[model samples]
Target: MKNKKRARSYPVVQVLSKTVYLAIPVIILFIVVSWFSFSEIRKQNNLAVENTVNIYQTELGHRLSAITHFIQWTVVHDPILDGFVRENHMGDYRNASNELRLRVSDMQYSTGDEYQYFFYWDEKDIFFNASEIKVDYDTYKEIKEKIRSDVKSKEDPTGSFSWKPFSFGGKEFLYYMITYRHRTFACLVSMEDILSPLYSLNLGENGSISAISPDGEVFYKTKEGPAGIISSVYNRQLFPASKSLLPFSLAIDSRVLGNYGKLFVLQVIVFLAALMLSFIMAGYILVSYKKVILPIKMFSKSLSEMDSVSDGEGLDLTDSKIQELNQINEQFKNLIHEITRLRIDIYEAELDKNKFMIHFLQQQIKPHFYLNCLTTVDSMVSLGDIDAAKKMLMFTSKYFRYLFQVDMNTVPLINEVQHVEDYLSIQNMRLSRSTLYEADIPSECNSMEIPPLLLITFIENSVKHAVPPEGESLKIWIKCRMMNHNAMEIIICDNGQGFSRDVLTKIRNGEDMEEDGNHIGITNCIKRLGLLYDNNFKLLTENNKPRGAKITLRIPVNDK
Candidate 1:
């Protein structure tokens, strides 16, 4: 016969496969998101560069216009210019030019510029004098020719002016001039000073400004060399002296193009890194689902199988693939053992209830029997059988009253001590033994709550088991006091034969006593103390110093 092949079972493998299937969509989503983020960053960077260029252009244009307006105002308002024109003298013109030059230099310092020079032309003498002590002869000649030409042609001279190839102190300047109606003065401010306002405007580290004349002459430039010049552009035709001015054309710096390229490369690198991290995260989740989730699922399955087993039936859940599942299976077995323990506890509770009912019924019968017997004995004592009837009546009524008075369970220490005295009184009447019972219970501990029947049981046990022999008087002492700020302790001691070592050990360890059924009362009291106070109570039993037994019960005060 051919052997049949068994089907393979691997929960981890199955879980891993499912996780990989789920990760496909997540990986695709991460890639799409990264791509969009990269694209948006690039777009935003381009817009930033464009906006920077636009702002610089607008600010440069405004600065250039302000410089031109200042020069026009100086020519029209200066006292020196008016004085020189009224006198029409070359010396007066020289003095006036020198004074104006000093004033203009001080103004230049405040305006954040290198120089501000003024020039004057007399139409009558055909003479020209500039504000500076030394003038560029070539620049002076060029301006003289332009003014003479305008005069000969009888053209309108009160308008905006421009000069190209104008040399000043061996350096070139693109001169911008404005003519006045009554005074013929040409203001010559360097193009460098005209755009110098850009430096003080604080355009930030990455921006530049430039000022250009109508004739394509660069007045000033920020940044040096080719980078500065190449960055600024001027349109001569659009800004001619004969034509209306046009707005400056603005554009992104060519150097910023390289920056954008570098940024694009960086963005590409970031996108690739993000993609790799996303893949790594997906792999980690898949591995976790396989390694952790699958094992837990197997453990859960084993528990379900174990739960289906009947009582006393064992389950085999030793799977070699998952050690954690094996441990869970072992825990399930322990749970089964715990269930057996619970069943035993239920049985014991029922037995205890039945025993309590029997005890309660026996107690009820003792009272009725004692009352009837006591009545007959009292009557006989009255009719001359006094000693016999008195002894019988005392013994019967004392014990009977104790057994029947269920309301005396949680009586105060003082009251419990009085009850003990009453029992001793009945015992003295019955026997030839004379025993003294003294109680010293603190008044402060009187109101502290204690379980009912606890003290009575201990007192009864002491009296019944520790009666003195003939001719020896028995002495019992009971004392209660606050042992500490939070605890109350009661000590009961007697001058009777103490218990053996074996009996003391058994009582301390809560072992059942085999000698008498009356030990049940002490056992019940111990159980009640444990249930009521838990860890807040202590009971100790020991032999007194010379002879007798001492029992002490310590209970924590209820602050509530």
Candidate 2:
């Protein structure tokens, strides 16, 4: 037979093809999603930075305006500064300084300074600090001159100055100057005031904001460089990073970009999704193999186990998870039941055929043996040996009666043995007691059920083959014994030349008799044994040590 292309033992056991197709689309979708997400992240991040800067700038400007309005309120409400603006005495300046200290000293910590006041009278070219004699000595020379020029050149007497160092009483002050009426007053200020709002912005890890004065001085900057130099993409995009083009610009930190690595996040999401998909696909394949392929394989294996000749049973249907497979299993079970019934019918037909063949062979042998026996009886009667003739005629009549009445398939062991004894009696009488036949069957084994003519064929073969020695009578032993609980053994041995080598080979090979049918008795015995015992019964023959044939049959016994 030609070997065709082999099929997979199990298709689900092979690699699934959907992985690449699923992965490619998943990757593409992830890329598109990540691109949009990154764009939004940058936009939102820039918007957040812009909002931070805007809020801080607005707060600073409002605080400064509040401070200006507060100063005007004090000038109108306090009599000390009013007295100093009305009177030109060192006594009034001292009172004004005392009032300034009382009003501003409690707020010094928020501004990074001690409460020190300095007032300059522009008309007199005179300045009075909190200590009129101490601060009036030296450090006010530059600010006093600038105030004079500013009071003459400006339209309004109200003015202000940026922070400057004024060394008075060996103490440096970051001073601011402002004019109220004709008196220019200077106060100390610092970056700590702006820092309160600056720090409040959410600068997050590497974020920074800068507040630069219009004069290009860095009033407050959390970091050194500009935001553009930090990230290459920062240069291409612009934001309201500088709020109002005034105080400061805010930038989200670039160095600690871990929080916004959206690409990495997208990759992780895609990886997890793909991993989950793979597990789902694997589970699907496993389900298919279990519910579909595995059941088919199991059915195939069960079919392999069946036999048409010897198997008289049906296969059991396996279970399945799918409903279709369950239906298939049900159909298979029904088919197997039908097959089993057919096999049983075939078995019964063969059994009936064997029984018929046995009956036909029995008929052929019975008439021949009976004819010879009647002829012997007639000769004996003619020779006036009336007693010998009666014995022969009576034994022959008894054997024929037993044979015609008994069941051919099975008979009691004792009855068959009695039948054998009756036949041997006729043979010994005819031969004048030339044969010595021994039947060693026990009473317990006598009721065992065996084939009706089982012992007769063996005995007939022995009678035909045995040739008595020159001086000794031929000895035959038909021994029956209970071998075990389930069976009995019968041994028929004779002192005769055993089978020839060719005949023994044919018997061992289990061949049927040839056309001439030499030793047909032995062949018929073997056929009956096969019909009744199948291969379970033992039928062995061997040459005995003293030149005889030993035939041992182990057959199942029935007591009832």
Q: Who wins the TM-score comparison?
A: 2
- Cα lDDT tens digits, model 2, 69-103, are 44555544656566565446777666666776666
Q: What is the lDDT of residue 454 in candidate 2?
A: 74
Taking the candidates one at a time, how many backbone clashes does each contain?
A: 1, 0
User: Which pairs clash in the backbone of model 2?
Assistant: none
The residue pairs in collision within model 1 are 409-452
Judging by lDDT against the true structure, name the best candidate.
2
Return the TM-score for candidate 2, rounded to 2 decimals.
0.41
Off by over 4 Å in 1: 1-402, 407-409, 467-470, 515-521, 557-560
